[model samples]
Target: MTQTDWPSKVTARVADALRARRKELGLSAQDVTDACAALGYPIPRTVIANLESGRRASVDVAELLVLAEVLGVPPITMLFPLGTAPTIEVLPGREVSMWDAVAWVTGESREEAMKTPTQTVLNMFREHGILVSVAMLSRELGEEKRREAALARDPEHRAKFLDMVAELDRIHARDIQSLRNWRARMRELEVVPPALPDEFAYLESSETAQ
Candidate 1:
């Protein structure tokens, strides 16, 4: 497919979120496109490739809905992770960012949501040793950073700061490695879209096909 308009930050975030979900589900571009077709949405594999590569910018509501269905996530979660704290204008005189509303809904401080990892990462960690949530790791990291910044004020806590760092390093080694692998895979997928599979080749007979 021909490239669409230059992508925006929102579209970029959506693309990252979509690619992340697809990888989590072990679904290829062809698998996603076929699922859309089964749902009667008929999303071509090139369209998915373009979207993931940020070559396709805007996504209409129908496409978004079908994509969410295929990926098995709520539609908004596909646009942005739930704890992202994205700002929004609710009404003419009132506005609330996601952080505020979520805090209110959950009866927790905004910091909690900010520190909490997305459900995806939490699930990943659950597959490993303990069910250590992202929030747990984030809290440790956040405290360490905060203490590290104040180290000049109290050099006595330097040892504690180092201890925190070591603890975090030990606890999050797998998560960090997994994140690195995920980013590398994303880079690989950002290359030119894959050629249509044999069954799909007949559907497109042009240089730019979808």
Candidate 2:
């Protein structure tokens, strides 16, 4: 009996999309290699073929980002099919990023789409509780990988990631409101946002999202 050797879900999804996209464009492995050369990446045809075949087990974030940009596929498509949104298991009583909510919806529908904030402002309501900045958030995400490794070793540790994401998301929501509210508050402070000296003179919300 042959035991199944399963790839990571993300890798499998990416491989499927690569194959589908190549077929849809009627492009061969050599064609992709040539296009990549023109675009200045110049990856070999065998590399393209290997990735498409799921023989490439790992890709760094930068490489994946470049591949998505080159292939005309959104980065998330390589993680999961875009037609249905992934289930967002939100803990009660927390504000999630509007973009993340939209992402979850898009994932459920599995559509290739994105939403971006005009600006995101974050708040840390308590000492030792708030990630101080976006820089801090990035650091926390990095730390979470270490946490994830620990969790992998102990099944009980995994739930912490979900909780951490929820907490971080709340801080991000506060930040979004912070950016929006800054204009009104700046007048009180006798200061103006550098982007616009004449406050409320030029404010246009993203029409694609609320």
User: What digit string (tens of lDDT, one per residue) describes model 2 on residues 1-210?
Assistant: 111223344455666777788888898878877877777777688877777777876556756666677678887666556454543222233334434544563443222442222111211122112323442454466466556655575555656665666666576566545545554454345443334223222342331142
**Model 1: lDDT to the true structure:** 0.61
TM-score of each: 0.40, 0.40
Q: For each candidate, how many residue pairs have backbone atoms clashing (under 3 Å)?
A: 0, 17
The TM-score, computed over Cα atoms with residue i paired to residue i, of candidate 2 is 0.40
lDDT of 1 by residue, 1-210 (tens): 112322354566667887998999999999999999999989899989998998987777898889999988877665545676576332233446855544443434354444444443433433332322442465468566656856646666766676666667665665545444443443354422233335334323543452
Consecutive 10-residue window with the lowest summed lDDT within model 1: 123-132
Off by over 4 Å in 1: 1-7, 85-96, 100-210
lDDT to native, each model: 0.61, 0.54
For candidate 1, the per-residue lDDT at 5 reads 27
